[model samples]
Target: MNDTREDMANRVFLISGGTSGVGKAIATGLARLGAKVVIISRSADRGQAAVKEISEATGNSRVDWFAADLSLQSSIQEVANIYKRKYDQLHVLINASGAVYFKKELTAEGIDRMFAVNVLSHYLLTNRLLDILQESGPARVITVSGHPRFLKNPVINFDDIQMEYQYSAMRAISQSLFARTLFAFELANRLEGTGVTSNAFHPGRVKSNLGRNAPWYLRVATPLVNAFFKAECGIGVYLASAQEIEYANGMFFDEKKRIIAIHTQFEDGAGNRLWTLCEKLTSD
Candidate 1:
């Protein structure tokens, strides 16, 4: 399908973390282009509010939302099942759901918080919906990844991926981002002939709630940092809607322009190992 804004009209878009920040911004922009958008959030009230606000702002009443924690495998599975039951097609999937913890935490499933939401949820949900996306054809999957600068080594540490022994908030978050990038590349490779494009992008630093759980100093400095350097939600809108990048698969982007990060391009063997590990971890 062509990338014209009018083409997006009636197209089905599903987004996670669309209640606020970059996710919400992307949802609003797509809704403005007349797409039928369904957002998933942890809070029903927040989800409803976001749907109403986006609908009112875009003058498109097709906006709706579902409630899901997204931090548990069961929740992710149930959400995907509900979506599949209602929608037969998914033209675009924007995975903007992410979180950073000030300290190491585990979900009800006993998985690391960073790994569960930022990494595992993206893997499971996208995989579950792959059939619909493939059937729809010419679909796009855009996952919001972290900046390359945050990852120094970008190793998966198969010995202790969840960092049960040497856990640190920063390290856990960084590894999750790297895993996300790795999964994006691996997904692109697997979906090569499926007419589905999978890519990852760094939205730059934005003043959002992603840091709400971080140190007080970071919370104080987030606004100042954003004032000096930050990418607005429009960057996400462009990647999700621009026709020029319809075939740009397996690439990473910063500020709407594709750039190669050396760390993310690990040996093919490493990527395959990571993919296998993810499959095992997310398996029922």
Candidate 2:
């Protein structure tokens, strides 16, 4: 994926969770290619720092950023509107913002933090920006899926979405896996021919601090977990650089060109159902 960005057709990319790790890696790479890149994160200082680093390294001042507390629907709306006014022609959206904690917690809006950040926020942001992406035509929507999907059963008790009964690290990971992946499939179906496509990527486990928000037990256990994994960043480039990036919508990808099986929760009906839930939940 190095330097193949010379002939890009005026693409503008919006990326969440861009302050560090995979997001920053991908953003810098894209900006180097002359692609307009926007990095989204929770802190304006962090987002701007990333933008400055990306711009300095790539020598492309086209890199920009928007800060939002994606865990809340209102912030999602605010940032999406800011993006619209900044970039009139949108081409790709990377829904990479995510958080996890050992204990279950709720956002200020009374939504579960894990579910809100990992699932609902992306759903709302993507749907809100659907029109700009459609207008950009041949746009791409890519999000990150953790390899934990294969290691765990991604089943959520829809009757108890708040996880009121049981809450654990494993439980939150499972629910996010199911909910977000299902949303990806449904989102693809919803905008199949509008010139926008949605897909998810599993950035191979890297030495990043994904478990930063987890409890001490997880913090002590992460090193053991990471031992079984490999480097992750290539997966980002693969998702961003695939030859058929436009038509390769609604698929799951790993580091290279390999396609992973969609989680068992991904049925056509489930996709639409999740989309409907998203719309109602985020409607002003």
The prediction achieving the highest TM-score against the true structure is: 1
**Segments in model 2 whose C-alpha atoms lie over 4 Å from true places:** 1-4, 148-153, 216-232, 263-268
**TM-score of every candidate:** 0.92, 0.88
Residues 115-209 of candidate 1 have per-residue lDDT tens digits of: 88888899888998899999887998999887767655777787798899998776787788888888888888899989999988887666577
Candidate 1 stretches with Cα past 4 Å from truth are 1-4, 222-231, 261-264
Model 2: which ten-residue window has the lowest total lDDT?
1-10
